[model samples]
Target: MEAVALHISNGVLNGPVSAIYGVIALVALAYCVSRGRRDLDDRLAPMAGLVAAFIFAVQMLNFPVLPGVSGHLLGGAMAALLVGPWVGALCVSVVLIVQALVFADGGVTALGANVANMALLGTAVAYLLIALLLRVLPRTPTGLGITAFVSSVFAVLAASQGFVLQYALGGTTDLEHYSLGAIAGLMAGTHLLIGIGEGLIAAVTVVTVARTRPDLVYALRGLKRPQPATAQGVAA
Candidate 1:
């Protein structure tokens, strides 16, 4: 049996559903581009390029999941944490577009669904979780690392479900042996392991950057640790 990449292939979804997702993706990315304009400045602009490139490179290396299914780094959480959410979406979208067009990794017709899932849904979910985690967790390198790990895991799971939802809506595959529930369960279970691997990579990467230059970490920017009481204040 040939290996199946996690990316949705052509003919998996009907034309109407695919077209609907394509429109949604275009509109969402247009919004991102509008917002990303403000987010991309001197520092972030360069970082965005690097983030996109890194994601593109890493996604090429696939790991075995089930018998014939393979998975790779989604890079949604990493991009959103490293850059802001808007630019992060763009980064992931660019990667997916390139992969589809150049490498034919994913189906060209399914590009919209791919972008919507990995770029928009994955990035949004991860960033929201990171924001929530940072509010309670210590705003240190260790804390950010933990946040990255947790968020990445959930992000991958969420992205996997996005596909399930799409499949439910307009799946062309025959379901003689498998039901929708079975498909969802399998996707969730396989993606759980993929999520763990992605989480570790995301954690280490975030922690390293946060330690060296926390300013560049978009997730760390708003987090402000309370200053410790000084010796002079204590003496007084």
Candidate 2:
């Protein structure tokens, strides 16, 4: 905890007044869209809640580098891969907001920036990458694994670059020790390695869904798994 605080003190990631407000506005938009269709089976609600809580738990484990410079799995891609993007974003954002308001892990002032980095950037980038890879890779479990792996890796790196950009646009710290270029490259590179872990988790989860409950692996279905009644009526 103190170590994280020290890292924050040493880190040069700050947003400008205008960008901060813009981030807040975007978060509000996302929050509004996050109602997530209550008509859907309520059982999924518990699944989503559990997934969010598990991600939060993993995030707290922060693997360290020299006791400070470390990366943690924020579960942006994992959530999106498990559920859909809208639900995934809402899950991560909820977790982040709670951390800020209740735990004081991220804080309210910079809450938007944190969301932009972890939830928005991470999920958006990962989704795009996976979509592209799916187009090229064979529609098989191996292909799913490969695509999930690469996308997860780059998404983390892109989030790091996003931070560098955000800070460069409105940074409050002296970036001499960690120049924008160096920071971007180092963080991205480290995240690329971390993505390996993300990739494996995503791949395993997808394959599990594919084998067990095909309805849950929406991405692979090529269509929304319509409710059972719809499928039964169509069959009849």
Best by lDDT: 1
Report the lDDT tens digits of candidate 2 across residue range 165-230. Answer: 777777776756877788788877777766666667667766665556655554555333343443
Relative to the true structure, candidate 1 has a C-alpha RMSD (angstroms) of 4.3
- Model 1 TM-score (2 dp): 0.91
lDDT of 1 by residue, 163-220 (tens): 9999999999779999999999998999998888889888998888877777788876
**Candidate 1, backbone clash total:** 0
Q: Determine which window of 10 residues in candidate 1 has minimal summed lDDT.
A: 227-236
Note the Cα lDDT for every prediction shown: 0.87, 0.64
In angstroms, give how far residue 150 of model 2 lies from its true place.
1.4
How does residue 37 of candidate 2 score in lDDT?
A: 52
The true-versus-predicted C-alpha distance at residue 236 of model 1, in Å, is: 29
Best by TM-score: 1
